[model samples]
Target chain A: MRLGMFFREALRSIRANAAISVAATVTALIAVFILGAFIPSFMYVRSAVSAQTSKVDVDVYISDTASVKQVNALRDKIGTLKTDGQVAEFTYVSKDDALRLMRERLRDPSVLDELPSNPLPAKFNIQPTDPANANAIVAAVKDDAALDPTEGIVYPQTTADRLLTAAKFVQWAGFALIGILLVAAVLLIGNTIRLSIFARRREVEVMRLVGATNWFIRWPFMIEGVICGLVGAVVAVAMLWGIKVGVVDAWASGADTALTKTGSAGGAIAFPLLTVVLVGAGALLGAVGSGITLRRFLRI
Target chain B: MARIDDDIHDAGSTPRAFTLVEVPLETVPADLAVVTPPASEKRRRGDVFRPGPGPMVQFQGVIKRYDGDVRGLDGVSVSIAAGEFVFLVGQSGSGKSTFIRLCIRELRATSGHVIIGGRDLGELKRSKVPYLRRAIGCVFQDFRLLPDRTASENVAYALQVTGHSRQEVNRRVPEILALVGLDGKGDRLPRELSGGEQQRVSIARALVNQPRLLIADEPTGNLDPDTSQGIMDLLTRINRTGTTVLVATHDRDTVDRMQQRVIALHKGRIVRDAEGGYNEDPGDTGEIA
Candidate 1:
């Protein structure tokens, strides 16, 4: 009977304050939709940043004290051992070839021409199995007696570290924005429910005078709040879905495909999923916020 | 101040000391008005303060002030017995409503105690207030029924608040509405019902809980004389059923015709509390005299 009474009252409040309930729902849906859409983008950006930071092209230089026959033998041996985890690829780089490649990259044509009789060393351009395996690859090479220790191996560690920090920043920023949005959700819900409850102060006072428990009075308002939040979430999700589809399919025209390999698939469904999350988030937030306000203002 | 303080000192020296009701503005003080039996003040040494047991509710040296601590019930002492129908009659600013407020735990007396059912209400714990409320029903002038709900819903609301089950609410609600002659009008809203019917609905809500005491603060304040008579008749019926009914009104005819106890408050003091004033004609009940 008590449960029925609460439900009946809750339904009455919702029906009575139709406009206010709609307003609350819309706010929640939009907030949740936005949060949902960004979550995918945030995750994608972090992963892309991670990939960039973790991959590198590496090269190991072999010295002249090592004879051609010995160096060549070592190269051939290391090339076959690539499947064993040390080397991703092993190929010989002749002094002349190295100079030529340097001229192409550096645009220093004069330096390449003045490479005194193949001054550039014969290098084994070795790509490690993984970027993280660079140091291990270097150590494995060092254990060999044939390699020169002076300029044994090199990988751009500093660039990788910077990229990692940038990825972390993107992830954290996404999370921070999500936190702010949730707070906004609660505030929106609180104001809406407060207005609805305020409209029927006499009704609430009468309830209190009758010895109604605090929650008995609060249940209907909280239920209405949750419904509002969910409705808003659904609408927001639809809007977000439209945005995602429109941008990728319609707006993506004349856009650089060379820029995005994954296309809208990168964050297409995330918006709809985001809407779902927003709805859930909105409902939870609305329920809690309404509870607090109702508890204070309504004596029961 | 000097004369009053001197009287207080002298009264304090006596054994039957009836001092002021002392408490905060929120806690309803128990005040017993020491009524002299016409010969006791001149004869007895200790019986000066004790008015002798007469009723359950008495205002003893009670005072009430609103803003700037102005007194509302000052040194008021009157005894109202259980099952007594008392009419609190006074003019505007006569502290009639203040007396009711004190009686129902709405406002506390500034000095003296306001006792109810042998409980010194000033000393009752705050959490137990709702429990105390369960024992007393309050009916207001505006017919404070929830407008959005139907008549039965409003009456059922009273029991539901006390966590009554479906069967109990269903059983008691109809019985109460029937008692107020609103038996079949349970599904109608307040606006749908007439003014008299609406007041009856309010009465139905008040009586649904079966409170030991019924306090109607101007129950028919908004009704015509004919309608007012109807409400009075309902009260008389309830009183006949053994519940003490304290009605606050400036209605002379209603008080006069009932042959009930009348307590008149002038400024904050009880100027009269007696069996008189009801034997007059049953005319002009709504006109403030």
Candidate 2:
């Protein structure tokens, strides 16, 4: 019953002060919309980078003079190589399989037909369970002197290094941008709630005089703020859904870009999860902003 | 100066020894006896006027100093019995508002003790201030009604905030409105009512909780002579029903006409404390007689 009264009072105040209410709701919608748009893109970029890194492996080529028994033994040893308790998997490709793969990748089979013999060597592809452990796996392979007959290992060090740098930059920049925007949203909501409460300070004084406890006087205002936040979040989520379906999907259909490929690979945040996060952030911002603002005005 | 100091000291010592001043029933006006609650219900509620030996309000050498070293109440000591209708009369800047604010615990006294219903306000925690205020009804000159709400809602709000049941609020709002002589005006908004009617609504709001004490700070300051008289009569009737009433007013005519116990202040000091009309003597300085 008390909660009902509080909500009634809050709704009444919201209607009475329409301009301030709209300003606060619109500010919250814009802020939450920006946050919603940024987070999925950030998640998508992170997943795409990690997917590229996971494809990196060390290739151990077998020497032509090495016996089949030696090659099998080296493969067994590479399979046992583990980093952080994660075993490496070895895929042994024969010389014929390598030649076949190269032939398929090449646009013209006539150039490959000019060679006197297949020049490609049989290699074992060593993959770590976790991409972050690739360096440790490579070090272990290099330390194995028993595999001396094998050709030198080939690890894409430059590509790995560049991917790591890009991931770190994106993570830090995403956090900084979200932090600035969240602060701006909080300040705008707080100021609007403060103004709304200031206009009704006389009513608050009367409530206090009539023996209303501090919480009793504060509940309505806080609930009003939460309602504003919830409305903004719902609107922003709807807009985000429209953009995702209309803009992003259309662009993806028209072009085969890297982003589209990543999207097809399921690199984006799930819509349900994104909606929950955006709505939760919006509600939290609204409640906290109004709660803090009421503290200064309602001294009862 | 020495005589004046002695008189102030004498008034300060009266409450310490628990002196009760009995005013005969015939001395009160006959017209103030219209509405009286039944004796059985009054006893069940344990009204403050249960022939108790203790004073309802006690101030022991209270000193309240504002910012910039200004004195709001300067070493003032007085006591009000449980059922007394006392008038706190003074000109502007004379500590009347300060005295009332201290009673409600709105402004803490810088020194000395203010005890209401046998509880020391200084020892009360900040969280308990609301409960303390609940025991005292306060009516202000500006009425302080929420302009957006009807008079009944304004009165029901007081009961609602104190956690009364909705049915109880519905039951009691009209009763209190009737008691305050705003019987049919419950549906009217504050702006639609006259200044006097608004003040009555404020008074009804104050009295809805059946507080032990009612403190009116110039409740009729904005009303004309006739409306002010009606408000004073309502206050007198409310007092006669066993609720202690303290009125601080600049209306010298009403104070003189009521002829209740008047406690007058000048420059934060109590100049006179006695059963009388408003003190008009210019030569008298802090003299009780």
Candidate 3:
């Protein structure tokens, strides 16, 4: 029953002090919106980088002079070198299969047809358990005597490194932005609560004289703060959902955009999870910000 | 009742269980017949009354010093028994406000102890201040009513904060408002009420909790002589119910007419303490009516 009264009081105060309430809510909305916008984009970049890195593998090309027995021996040797499950799996591609894959990938059959014969070599694709360990596995394979007849080993080192660096930068920048925005949101809410408390200072004094407990005086203001935060967060989430459906989905359907590709590959956090996070953050900020600001006024 | 008093004194080592009783209502003077008979009976049996051994308020060598060596109260000692109506009269800056503030624990004395209802203000913790304040009702010169709240809400707020049920608050608010003669004005905001009506609402708010002590600071400073008389009469009625009433005022005429115990202060010191009027001038009768 007391909680119900507190809620009624909070609602009434919010309605009565519209200016401060709106200022706090709008500030919270902008902060949460900025946070919501950055989080998914950051997640998308990180996931895309990880997906690309996972595709990194060493392709060992076999020379035409190499014997079938030698190739088989190399395969057995590579299988034996799988210590602690460092190498995940391996597959063998024949010359004809490689030529077929090239033709399919290039989408141009004329170039392949002009060749006198299939100059493509059979290759063994080695998958490492961790993309970070791919280079080490490649070195081990190259140093082995049985793989002496290999033509070359290819791994997209430079591209993977660049993508990982970019992902790291995005992660740092996202956290920094979120930290700054959270401080701004807290300050805005605190200032708004301070103004409301100042306006009702006489009432607070009366409450004190009446033997009201400190929590009794504080709970209503805290509830009001939470309402402001909840409203702001709800609006921010609605805007984010609208943008995702209207702008992002439309652009993705019309043209193959990076965001669309990331969305397909589960590059960002789930929508429901993001909603919970934003809402929870909003409530926490409001409760804590106002709770701390009310300390000075409650001294009366 | 004697056993309870004995237990309280023996339980002094365990402060949590110690309870102070107020003065009995039978001690009220016979001439103050304004106290309703039923109310006095209720107070006699009600949980609100707890008769104790000491005075309602005791100031022992109290001294208050502000910054730059300014004295608010200098070596002033006084005691007010329960159920007594006393007037605190002095010029501005003569420690009238300081005396009231000290009783409510709003400001600590620079030296000496202030005991109210057998509890020392100096020993009270910050967390326990609210409990201390709940035992005392306070009124101000400005009436301090919330501008947005109706008079009923202003009065109900006193009960609500002390954890009274909604039904009890609803029942008691109107009763107190009626006692203060604000029967139908409970719905009016502070701005709508006259200054006298607003002060009465404030008084009702203060009295709603049935506090043992009521301290009014310049309650009649803003009212005309007639309205001030009405407020004083209401206060006297409250006092007759066994609540110790203390009024700090600059009104000479009310002090002279009421003939209550008057304590005069000058430069933070008690210049006079007698049962008469504002000043202890020659040829002024000191007899109570």
Best by DockQ: 3
lDDT by residue (A1-300, candidate 3, tens digit) is: 899989998998888889988988887788788888888887777786677667778888877777888888778866865655878888888899999999999967888889999988888898888777777777777754434254677877886677777768877887897898888888888888888888778778877777777898899999998998989999999999999999876887899766566543577678899999998888877887789899998774
TM-score of candidate 3 to 2 decimals: 0.84
Model 1: per-residue lDDT, tens digit, A79-156? 665868767776778777887787888955786666457666777777667666666666666555456568666667
User: Per-residue lDDT tens digits of candidate 1, residues B126-219?
Assistant: 4444555655778888989898889999988887776666776776677677767776889999999988899999888877666657889888
Which candidate tops TM-score?
Answer: 3
TM-score, model 1 to reference:
0.71
What 10-residue stretch in candidate 3 chain B is worst by lDDT? B11-20
TM-score of each: 0.71, 0.82, 0.84
Q: What is the lDDT for A115 in model 1?
A: 48
Report the TM-score of candidate 3, chain A only: 0.82
List per-prediction Cα lDDT, in the order shown.
Answer: 0.69, 0.80, 0.79
Q: How accurate is candidate 2 locally (lDDT)?
A: 0.80
Q: Which stretches of candidate 1 lie over 4 Å from their true place?
A: A56-158, A241-276, B1-79, B91-129, B266-271, B278-289
How much DockQ does model 2 earn? 0.57
Q: Write the per-residue lDDT of candidate 2 for residues B106-215, one digit (tens) a residue.
A: 89999999878676778766666776677689999999999899999999998788776687778778877887888889999999999999999999998877777899
Residue A68 in candidate 2, Cα distance off native in Å: 6.7
Clashing pairs counted in every model: 29, 0, 5
